[model samples]
Target: MGTATKAILTVLLAFLIFGAAYASSGLSIKSELKAVTIKYSLEGTPYIDYVGLQLPEIEDQISGISQDTTKILLSRFYATGLLYNASKANENGYFTWSGELKMRVRVGQMTTDVNVPTTINLYGEYDADGFLRSGRGNLTTCIITISLYPPYTIGLSNPINYSFDLNSQTVNLGEITQLTGIVSLFATTTALIVALTKDKDLTLISET
Candidate 1:
């Protein structure tokens, strides 16, 4: 082979290898609601209907534990309700309205189901309107961070054990960054209450 031809082949081979490693450019995650349930307060013709996790920021903050650049998926926690308490239905029939959250990361490539934990729970609840309301949880995948300190380390971190209180606004939940992947699926309902609620109180509580 000619010298120029050999040189070109070498460059091409290098490019191919590099592409395979970072070809993903950025991270793209696909998800969908696995199990879903809905309950009415008054009777028929629902006034409020919602589902999915809550306090997205909290879950992001916890699961965001990374070593370097956070290109790796660690552990993840998911819940069926977030806007409020996720109570248990008087009965377990079957329902699937479905829900999910899509995210674009700066850079990452890895299988999420590897060497990590994924958790999902739904406590369910009854809203102030006498209807059920407990949609308790935060969502997302991912982390642990360490701080530099001496032996004088003070006892800190999520004070309780097991998990956060899934029934309250201050409840705990894996919690992510640059982080615009705030998934709040409880924003809409068959009654369109989310639109009005978002302006009056929902947004305010979420921001806090």
Candidate 2:
């Protein structure tokens, strides 16, 4: 093996078998998650309507799966804040209301409550006895659908419906049920799955 040291050990054994076949599979989501446009104000609320709902677990903003492989991944990040053009809610300046949309699923610790049927796309300004003196919303329900439930060996990256968009930047809204600004989350792809745990008493889901 002296032919230039056998071509440097055959290119270091093909870079360690292409880094272990790209860490054993696919998936490489990305997103520092940024998108701000928060400007809400409500004075003397007597219930003029102002509700929000968004489930953002995202497996910790995702990154090559961990946290026990997202419990078995076969998800449905539920989306319900209505505004995909419902006649723009009665074509006016802007006015729409109707809330409530919660999702909780954990089939290993007794916890499964999924309620879907929501609508709320607040506009802005409304005084003279109708709480919500000011309003502005943009962070509907987190929409996502994941799949990869087997003996652990995924290689997906063919449009699994992974969308990511939300980047405005205009913060100056005084909270309306804990608004921290920014939105939209993502989890990349292109070979990246370094989690190993098929079944050794697999049970890790109950983090609602």
Candidate 3:
């Protein structure tokens, strides 16, 4: 092979190696509605929902943890009943709704196995008409703040805990609240490669 050809091949080889090492352009999140259901009573029916876990931002904030960038997810807590709780066919059921917050932080290729703090707060209210309404259809209305701190050890059963300070304005949970976070596609890829590399007998060669 010619020297020029070898040089070109070397460059290609470097990129290939880098590509293998660099898996994510940003972080990513895996989320699910851990639990959700609707309850019925003579007065009214209440809805209950739960978000399993919030993910990290996959775009925008690709860099490590930053205050300017945030990774947060808001959840709504729901319930309903009338002033007089009743199960009879003629009475209406009183209902109430609330919300809780959970946070997940991602650093580099590792989604630091940390205990995320979550709290359920009253987020819904009933009107004179007996209609259930939330501050917003979803908690997306609130400006969420995300702060990534250094990785720390968390027990298998212990997770970070955070509670929302209830206010008159925060209640009613008829609908689902969106959970948002900072996840990196790049970071994910990095993690996969590291794991695979550990078990592989790797080989490298320049491309022409």
Q: Write the per-residue lDDT of candidate 3 for residues 1-208, one digit (tens) a residue.
A: 4557556755665564454334322122223211212221211323332222111222232122232211232222321231112232232233233332332445556564333333332334433322222222222213333345554433332222333221112122212211111133344445546644543433223321
TM values, all candidates: 0.19, 0.25, 0.20
* Worst-scoring 10-residue span by lDDT in model 3: 173-182
- The residue-by-residue lDDT of candidate 2 on 130-178, one tens digit each, is 2223444422233223334533332222221111111122222223111
2 Cα displacement, candidate 3 (Å): 55
Per candidate, the number of residue pairs that clash is: 31, 7, 47
TM-score of 1: 0.19
- Model 2 alpha-carbon miss at residue 122, Å: 3.7
Q: Would you list the C-alpha lDDT of every candidate in the order shown?
A: 0.30, 0.30, 0.30
> Candidate 1 lDDT, tens digit per residue, 75-122?
122332333223532322222223332322221332222122223343
Find the candidate with the highest TM-score and give its number: 2
Give me the runs in candidate 2 sitting further than 4 Å from their true place: 4-6, 13-78, 81-97, 114-119, 123-135, 138-208
